[model samples]
Structures are given as structure tokens and as C-alpha cells.
Target: MKRKINSFSRKITNNPNLPAAHAMLYATGMRESDFCKAQIGIVSNWYEGNPCNMHLDILGKKIKLSVINQKNLIGFQFTTIGVSDGITMGTPGMRFSLPSRELIADSIETVVEAHHYDGVIAIPGCDKNMPGVMISLLRLNRPSIIVYGGSISSGFYNEKKLDIVSSFEALGEKNTCKISEEEYKNIIKNSCPGPGSCGGMYTANTMASALEAMGMSLPYSSSSPSTSENKKKECKIVSTFIQKLLERKVKPKDIVTKTSIENGVKLAMCLGGSTNLILHFLAIAKSANVHFTLKDFQKISNQVPLIGNLKPSGIFLMEDIHKIGGTPVIIKYLLNQGILSGDCLTVTGETLHENMKKIPNINFNQKIIYPLNNPIKKNGHIRILYGNLSPEGSVAKITGKEGIFFRGEANVFDSEEDANKAILNHKIQTGEVIVIRYVGPIGGPGMPEMLKPTSYIMGSGLGKNVALITDGRFSGGSHGFVVGHITPEAQSGGLIAFVRNGDFIKIDAENNLLTLEVEEEEIQKRKKEWIPPLLKVKKGYLYKYIKTVSPASEGCVTDQF
Candidate 1:
């Protein structure tokens, strides 16, 4: 039964004074009984420039051939770097899409700590390759798993259901002529009909159903699909559960705690998901060192309730919740309504209450996941707002289908291509509140993601009589009455940089408030004639990510300010 060699692959493979690291891992071939096996570092954030990580190099060669057919394991595969925030959403290459989630977690923690790999599988498809490979498997507290390269099937057209946010709302329904140009070129050629990721519940199926309800992938590996055979047999059952998680050395900080990051924010606030899941779950609860904040997502969005109707804010997708019984039947309906925390742990080393006692029951006559006593929103739609234009707080996806009181009238625009060219040139109006403001994260040093100005304010029907505030961030195919991670961010000065154009903004989202109604001596005389705006990339890696990022209320993270 011989299975015990991994102490970082026994100090770089069967020592004997590491003969030049076993002739450089046999010059990329390896054998000598693969130095008595245990290596394992698959990684794969593959490319082809995007169909959300074009079939993740065929699920990284079927999870490196099921982690080298199990027993004592060996696998190596590598590759990282993915950025298509749906192909650089309103370009400058969408400021390298949130700095390619810190360059895919510093190129997978510098190739699993310079090739000492003794556990890590990751795979990941788009939208910051699932929290940049779960923050490089919580900063290499290894024996990791995460398979999720699924989701992509839904494209049709005449039969309707197309995706890639239906070609970013068909370029705002072809610049407001409301479709034609052969129906915006057949909704961008039947809206992404191949590979996967971005088939709603966006932000790559909302960080793959919040890392499979924070056990970090497995259990209907976040609702399958990328041309399913159950997402290639859940990548060979997460490569035979990463050899029982490296023979029980179960890591990733023993399955990401703080109650599984509040069971991944209570399954991304019961699947209404994305305000970029409050900036990729606060950069994966600060790389799972976990002291999570942004008010621990409004205290688990005041007790999770939205209940997955899906899409840019409902009407089903992640392949109709993988035909109504996936995501382990919505984590066994949020663990029989005690709203998740089924004893956490997972990578199939069980407990999420022993994987919800072999999941199954949620058919409740299918309407695509509702049944928490008739919910679509009785609570969590991811709000976290705070007043005085976000005094260190903000993030609103709001899903009570938008009307939680918005007061409007600001219209400003420091850029998301000038508020997507003033909402596709109709000059954004209807009780206005647009205000894109110096694109946060050290002011657009790389914040970028306003999903084409909130899909041109919902293809110009102005989604619910207009509203959009931002310090930059959105595109879980963005929905309206929007708001995004604002903080002391108009390049750190906050008060949304003393907002100005007709100032009157008062979003209350049922009293989580974001008010800006001016007059603290006219906001200190427009913050004494505000000025700070110049360094738009004075050099690379976004001028060292605008000299160290943070402040999207502290999760626009670049090593925490």
C-alpha cells in the first residue's frame, strides 16, 4: 500500500543529495519510480485567449490522467494566466482585469514554491480564475483541490437563451436601436457556443458556486456543463480526490475556515451572486488567513435568502442549476435551511455534514432553486453599503429586483470609457446617478469591470429608471440599480471624490444607505477643489498596482495595502 512520500516530494525527490534535483526531474520526464511518488501540481488556468479558459486544456489532461492513476501519485502539469473579463470589458484591456487576480496568484505561488509540489490541482476557468486559484490554494497550505472548469452550454437564439450576457446585452441592443443589424449579428454569433464559463450565475458561476459552498469544489462541482459528461466526470472525481487529499494531510488551511468563510458567504448569498462576490470573497478571505470583512458580507447578507433563479439577476442558467439537482441540491437546500455550515471541511474528505448525506432531495417541482419557504429575496442579495458615500463600505447587487429605494441625480464620469460613452450616447438620464468615478483600486490602476457600463444601463432601457455608482467593479454579467465596492477610493480621498454633477445620490437599499446629498459646507467646498488624478500607469504591473492596492473597503487587495 506504499503511499507516504510527500514532505514537499521528500525534499525535491528521493534525496541522495538531490542529484541536481534528480537530473532536473529527469529533464521533464521523470521515472526511477517517479522518486517514490506524491508530487501532484496540476494548476491549469489555460488559454486560447478565452472561451473562458478554452476547455482548460481538456481539464488539464483529465486531471493529469487522474493524478497519475492514483496510488502514490505523480502528476505535474502547469500553466496559469487568464483575464477575459468577457474579453477585457471596456478596454485598456480592462486594465488587465483586476490585475489578473494578482497575476494568477503570483503564477501559482511561483510554480508551487519552485516545483516542490506535493499537492494542488486548481483548474479554474474565468473571472479571475476562481479567486486566482483560490488565492494560490490559500497561499500554499497545500493538499488543495478545486476542479471547476465547467459551465458554458447555454447558447441558442431563435430559441432564445444565449449567453456571454447575451453579447453584453447585444451591445446594448445595438446601441439602443433595440436590435437589428441582423439582430446584433445573431446575438454575437449565437453568444459563445463553445468552451465554457460565463453561462450565467456569472463570475464563473459565481466563483463556482462559492467554491462548492466553500468546501472548495466537488459536489456537482458547482453545477457542471462545459460540454458535460458531468464536467468530465468531475475531472476524474477531482483526480481521485487528490489522492484522498495527499493521504489525509488535508490542507488549504484545513479547508478554509472562519466557518468555511461563512460557507463561502452563505453560498454567495444564496446564488444571487456577484458584485464580484464582494471582490472575490475579499480576496478569498485574505488568502484564507481569514479575518474576513466588508462586514462579513453584511453579516452573511443578513442571513442568506435570495435562492438562485440565476442569470444577470435571475431566469435560470448554470445549465438550469445543472438540471435542478446540482450544486448538491443547493447544498441540500442550504443544509435543510439552517443555512449552511454543515460542519464545513470538504475536498470530499467529507463533512459539509458528510456531503449532505449523499445529496438529492431538491426537486420541489423545479423553478430552478427556490424553496427556502418561497424566496427570491427575503434577505441576501449581497448588499454591504454604508453612508456618506461609503464611509469605508459599499457593494450592492441588491436583488429584490432592484427597487430598494434609490434617489438619483449625480451623472458624473471619470471613466468606464466615459460611462460607456454616456450610456451609448443617449446621454444617460432618467433620474440619473451614473457616476463611474476614478475606477477604484488605487483609482483604476486596475479596478476595471463595469460590464460595459452596466451593459449600457441594461441595453438603455435604463434598467429601472437608472442608477449606477462605482469606484469600479461589476460583471457577474452586471445587473442594474447597481453599485460597486466604493470606499475611500476616488483615488483614496473617498466621498466618491466629492461627487458633483447635480449631486443628489441617495441609494438606501433598505437602509444600508450610501447617501451623498452634499452640504458639509458643500462637502468641504468640493473637497477643496479636488485634484489627485494623473498616474494612469507610469510603468508596469499598474505602476506597481498603484503603489500597493487595497480600499475597495479593503479587498481590492494587493497584499492588503
Candidate 2:
């Protein structure tokens, strides 16, 4: 029989496997006689190949020292894969990016749970890293802390800040010969200067903000630039925060309550954060057993308004948000507006209101974030619509600036590549609703974000006139009159697949609707010939994903129970 540890060291520690554990530690030169006191796992998603996470290696080293030298806890550092969405976009490699979220979550669970670590601190910089670590924390139900790797400062081109989105649009600009090859090369060199996730309110920053609002991270931890000394300070500060959490035995489930989840959505809408958050937030709530649905987002949206003046939807960078405080400015303003829940708890071991007492109210001079009463938009920034085209509903990310209603002839393409080709070849016409289908959770196998195509449309100077609709979702860097996350997706026989070229389609966000203005009998007739496409891969994880992953409406999660 394997021996189990007695309860002398603590209730959950100092196991009976003490003899073998001590022997292995002593052999490894970690010669603390009573070493099995407290173990805190420092999980990291660090890789040299991607700028989004390159800083984490250094961050992790500092945190490990703090954990052992200052806090007197034995810290074990481990790493996992971090696939860069920016590097992989518009290629077969992109298929692996979303799948990597699942792998990272599972890896955290496997490593931490297997060791029975008393607490865990996750430092993740890339897009999937935030939610993946949080999901594992929920499952472990241990004292956990999440520290974001931070955003990169905007690079400069044409005397303006250039980010990843600017670079993507520049490609289209070069394709159209509007910009000379020299200008294109200049943008390529100037758009990204150093380590960090792509700048603007892309997935990396959006989800990082979400994690903070969900109370999984320390306040003001999400908006600082990746390379700043402030980011270094934050890692050390959060290290101490985790020690405090371990003392109180507070946990993820205790903090990620229904109110906190709503708080996350409120920040997402107000910040004009990514639409990918819808799927990610749902997955997290499900993991925590929190009762969150699409209606909850809409209910909160009815109360909150668009305030984040940044990114693909707005005109500032995250570095700007950091200048006049950080994400907490928006969080505090929303909290005081009576639109947010004060009953919620955070990782700080206090109620939401208690924590809000420290953050100063929004500075009127701050243009990046406006006062709640004087929001940039009167309605929710992202509106969910349901109609003939998306019977289960679709997402429309509209700034108050973009017209809420659009009626145009359809320019249908079966895949993202096909639509991308049409746009590059000038086959796409003005006043057309470009329908790209068969790229849902199962169909695309990963439902890659349409930044490539959308950026192309904007670069080609048709952003104001043309619109695109897809069963897949969009990056936070994607804007214009685009509607995505069309449910009962193309592969599942949604009306989006039945859309033929030149067919009339309407996306009306004014009343929340996405409709195919075609005869009912004619739609039924097309449905008879509609067949789910064959799997691109014969086997492996993607094949398993097709069988197990649920719909986008259900958060695109693979695990059922």
C-alpha cells in the first residue's frame, strides 16, 4: 500500500510519502530538511518564439525567487505551449491556435493537480493563456492567482501608432497598389518593435481585462504595457497577493461568482473588448458551475454602454488606458454608476465595493475612457441578433458610429480563403454582404478569427460600404459592419449556408436582427441539398474536437460534464 501523509504539517499537506519525497529533494540539492512545508506551483506559458509570451520567462524567474526567498514557500516552475494567434493567422497553422487553449487548460490541471500543490500562480501573456489558466484554477478549486503578461506599446508609422491591425491592413493596402512597396516595407518594420501581444484591444488584452473583472487577477494588472517597469512591479505585487490568498484559503470558485461573471461582461461591453470573450466567458462560467447564459450578457448590456475608446472599434491604444490609471478606471466608474454589482468578491479577499474604495474615479481629462453617463454609445457596443439567417442568433460588434442597419446583396464564399481571394482579386463589390460559411466551431475545426479578410475589406476602402457575416467569430481588432458567431452554424445547417450570390440579406442591429430575405419554401429546398462537409483531417485531436466540442452557443467547450 502506498503511504499517505499525516496531517501534522497542515490539514492538506505533509503526506506519508514523505520519505520518498524528501529523498528525491535531497538528491536534487534542494536540501531543506523540512522542505515539504508548502508547495506553490508557478505555471507559465513562456516561449521565445512569440513576442506575446517572451517576457514571461523572466517574470516567472522573479516570481519563483519571491515565492521561495520572501514568502518561504517551495515554488515549482513549469511551462506549457503558447501558440501565437498573430503568427498563425491566415494559414493552416491558425487551426492549432484555438485548440491550444484546450491543451493549456488541460496541462495546468495535469501538472498542478497531480502534485497536489497548495496554491498556484499562472503568468500567461498570449490570447488563450488567460482563460486556459483560469479554467484549470476553477477545476482545482485551490488558492490561485492570475497575472497578465501585459500589452505592447503601439509602434509608430506615419507619425501615428501602428499595431498588428495596422500591419494587416497595410498588406491589403500594398495589394491594392494604394501604398508603394516602400511604404509597405516601412510598416512591416515599424508596426512591431518588441515583445508583447499584438497591440490594441485584441484577444490578448481583451481576455486579460476579462480575467481581472472576473476577479481572478489583481486590479490594475491588465492594462499596463508588457515591457514597462510597471509590469515587472505587478508580477512581484501579485506574488505577494497570492501569499495572502493562500493564508485565507480563498479560492477561484469563491471569487468567480455570478456577480463577478456579470462584472466581467460589463467591463467587456464597456471596454469594447473582443467578441471571443463570449465563448471564453461561457466556458469559464460553466466550469465554475455559475448560471450564465447569453441572456445574462444582453441583460447587462441593457444597462451598460460603450465607453472604451480604443482599438478596432475606437481610436486609442492600451498604453493610453494605462496613462490615466488602467482598466480599473473603467471598472470603478461602472461600479459607481449603479450598473455593476457590489456584492461580488475578488481575489483580494474583499467585496467588490471594498476594493473599489481605493481606485480614483475617472478623470474628466481622460479621453480614452468617458464618464458612464456620457458614454461613446447609448446602447451595448456588441449586440446579439437573431433572425432567419441565424436562427440561434449571431453577434454584431457595432460602435455607435457605424450604422446599425445594413441591407445589401450577398457575395457568398464557402471558406475564409475563398472570400480572401475574392477581396484581393477585386471580385468583391460595394454594397455587398459577404457571406463566409462552413467555418464554425466544428466546420473550421477551430473557427479562426476573420481579421485577414476584414482587414482586407477596410484596406480596400470598402469598410464603410461593405459588410461581412460569418458563422465564425472576429478578432477584437476586426471592425466595420461585420456580424459573426452565427449559430446553428453553416455545418449544422444554419440559413447562412443557403445564402446564394446576389441574394438579399439584412443585418439590423437597431432592433437586433440578421435575416435572409428569401422565400421560406426556397430555403427548405436548399436545405434538402445541404450536406455537412467532410473532415479535413482523418484523425488526431482535430478529429476528436469534431466529435466532442459543443456549439458556439454553448461556448464551444469540448467536455460535456
Candidate 3:
């Protein structure tokens, strides 16, 4: 009889020695394109290859060439090995550029069963990978740890260090003023430097940081550069930690407790994390059967102060964060100030409180992480508002601007494309609330981040006195008074869909209100005749996504649960 080949057989045959291997599985969702794009070399070679090449230039040129240079050359042997490992490790999927959640979940299931793996390590970065991995882990309900692919190196455009957030904004600028093609290419090249973290405090980076803060990740793991010699060490550390977790029989449910979820939310707020986190975290919590909701975020945001001044929100980068003590330092400060749940257990086999003791001292003045007395922002990290425009509640960060909460006439853009065009034309006005509709989960179909246009608006000096409300998400680094993840999104006949240009909209951050100043009867009439935007995707993963994904307020997750 011919041997059968199925998901179960694949699981059993891959690793037959460890019967528990059937219970021990690891899965990682990465932007395979991004991973392939990462630069890798041996430790010594990488140090020697630094742009400055100071090590080579110093210690006398000949000695440098003989000792440093030659030693570095020998280390280059690992470069090919590293690159091959990266490629092979990421070669198991169909969709290379961007894999869907279902694809990731199915791949994870296959890998787990084949390896007879007991636990999983989800190496994910970028927007989709994190959520997909999280969903997969939730379904697997096994021991899991999320390892992020680190941020890309900051690029230079017109003599300025260009990060991913800025790169996207620069794309929308007038052609005459934008960076040259070569410069853009260089920017893309430098934008993603290594492996463990996302480029900026966008959804990817923010979510990773939030996970670390929540004690779901290894200590200092969130901030380590993917290309650093330390990354391999970190990966080994993660693998070892997972093994220990399994030995102890500790599962993801134990780590992702209510207190852990609350800590995650508080960290999200303190970092001024991506509006997407509001949805992603909620979904993760839901998968664990934890009762986390939008109101919980609002409640936490009301108290947690925005710190970590990086990216679109502030200067500095993830590398800078690592130098300034990373998430452990931040958690310690929150714990000292009674802002975080110090007793929560992390995957490190220590309570969050115990982890803080590992850090001898933290300097808030350095500004990598801020203290409660001298915070980056006065109020909580995020604010939740509701009104006739967003009956299901909308989320906004209150870290940057304070004047956007007052009533104003709405300036509606039917789609992100139109909004971009309007901004390019300099049609946006001060005191006008710019509303970008039809870009929510079912609307944008994937609820793509609208950080591009929002960044342009803020960078152009037009956003100083204006507010932006949208069904889309803003990067964690996006400051200013921006409200996002409005649900039911306009596409699903939410009140946001009924919003018209020149309509009076009120955004009261103080009382958590985002009401439209229209009569109930008129609102009802608009709803009756409201036509949902045409679906953005009609086939393939995008189609499945549009059909199965929930609204932004509901975490924009598919029906995997």
C-alpha cells in the first residue's frame, strides 16, 4: 500500500524522535519579501562593513587589514549560510509578497502537525504578518512567542535621514520637490536594515512593543535589530524559552491574562501606538476568550501617558530605544508609577515586576522613555469618541494636538485616493475636520493604513489646526489629533457613510464624543438611501478578506475564530 501524505502525516514524519514534537510546533509569519530584502553578514564582517569603516581605518591600516579585515573575511562564511537560512526558512508559502491570514494559519497548522511540535514561535513583521500570526497562534492555542523582524536602516533623501513613515509621505509630494528615483531606491534599501523589528513605530513595531510590554515576548527582544549579531542570540533565546515554557506546561493563555492585556493596552497608549493596535489587540484578546473591548482601551488611554518619542510621533528610532533600555525600562517606570500590572508573568518565566529589577536604573531624562511626572503627553495614550458620525465609537491619540476636539464643519473625502488628490491640490483648510471614508475593513477591504496622506497633511503644515477622522488606521508614529478605526465603517452603512461635506461634526475628547450635529430624521433619511462603496477586491485573498473580515472596531480580523 502506498503511504498517505496529509497534514497529519507530514507532522508525524518530520520529527519522529520526540513524540511531544507532535505537540511542539513553531510558526512565523514574515513579510518574506522583507526578510529576503534584509542584509546579512558574519558578526565581524558586519562590524567591519559599517559605513564609517572606522575599525578598519583605525588601529593602523596594515594591522587593521591583517587582524580586523582578515578576521572579518573569515566570518563572511556565515553570510551565505545566514542568507540561505533566511530564504529557506521563509520559503514554505505561496503568496510571497504578502500572505493572507488563512494562508498563514493553514501553513502554521501544517508545520505544527508535521514537526509534532508542542509550541510555536511566530516571527512576524509588517502590517498583515503580525495579525495573521496572532490569529494562527490563537487557533493553535499552544505555547507561542512572537519575534518581530527588526526595523530597516534609516535612509537618506535630500540629505535627510528618511524612515519608512517619511518615505510614504514623500511619495505624495509634488514631483519637482520629491527625492530622485535613485534616492528613493536608496531609501527603500536603507528603510529595512535587519530582522527582528519593524521599520518604525507603525502597527508592526508598535504591536511588537505592546506584546513585549504585556510580557508575551522575551526581554529586550522587541528592540533588537534584525541584522545585529545579537539577533541570532535572541532567536536562540526565544527557542530556549519556548522549550522551557513547554517543560513547565505554561501556555499562551496563562501569559495573556486580563492583567497582561491591560498592560499591553497601557503600553500601546504610552507608545502612542498604531490605531490598528486597537483592533489587533482586541482580536488577540478575543481569541484567548478574554473580554477585551474598545471601552477598555479608552479607559486605559485615559490614564497612560504617551512616551516613547519615535517616528511620525517624534524623533529617535527603535535602535535608540534599545540603547535607552527598551521596553523593560518603560514597564519599570509604569510599575513604579503604578501604571502597569507588575505582577503579570511574562514568557521569560519571571513576573513583569521581577524583570524590572534586572534593569539597575532608568533615565527618563534621556527621553527614550518618559516618566509620569514629565510625560510626553498629559492625558492617556488614546481617546475613544462616539457621536452620530460614529455610533460604534472611534479611536484617536491625544498626544500631539489639543484643539481638534471642538466642533467643526466636516470636509469629506469619499476615498483615500480622493483625499490624497485633495491634499496634493492644497484644498484642505484649517479648522476643517477631514473625513476619509470608505477605507475601513470592508471598505478598504484590508483597512490599509492611511498614514501616507495623514503624514502628508501633518508635514505640509496644513494639519497644525486641522483634525483628521477616518475609517482607516494611522501609523503609531503618526501624531496630531487623528481619529481612526471608525465602525461600522462607511461601507457597512455606519453613520460615517452618511457624513456629507459641510456637515457640522463635533469631536469632544474630554467627554469621549464624536457626534454629528444633524437632526435624527435627516440622519435616518441619509441611511435609508446610503449606497455602500463597491468592494475593492472581488477575487482571491482580498475577496475572502473583504467578505470575512470584521469592522475596524472589531479588530478587522477574519472569521478564523
Tell me each candidate's RMSD, in Å, in order: 19.7, 2.9, 10.2
Tens-digit per-residue lDDT, 1-561, candidate 1: 455747787777767987988998889898787788888889888889898787898888988988788767888888888888877778888888888888899889998998888888888888788888898788888888888888888778887888887787788778878778898888788888898888888777888888888887788887888778987887876767878878888888888898887887788778888878778778788887778878878878888788788888887888887887778877877788788878878888987888888777787787777777889888898788888888888888879777988897898888888778778888887988888878877778688887887877787778989888888888888898888878877877888877889888899888798898877998888888988878687887888887877776767778873
- In model 3, where do residues sit more than 4 Å from their true spots? 1-102, 113-115, 156-160, 171-198, 402-404
**Per-residue lDDT value at 506 in model 1:** 90
lDDT by residue (132-226, candidate 3, tens digit) is: 56665666666666655555556555576666556555544433355566765666566534333345566667777778887777877667665
Per-residue accuracy of model 2 over 122-189 as CA lDDT, tens digit each:
99998888888888889888888887888887889888789988889998899989999999989988
lDDT of 2 at 145: 86
What's the count of clashing pairs in each model shown? 1, 3, 33
Q: CA shift at 516, candidate 3, in angstroms?
A: 1.4
The clash tally of candidate 3 reads: 33
TM-scores vs. true structure, each candidate: 0.37, 0.96, 0.78
Please state the error at residue 59 of candidate 1 in Å: 30
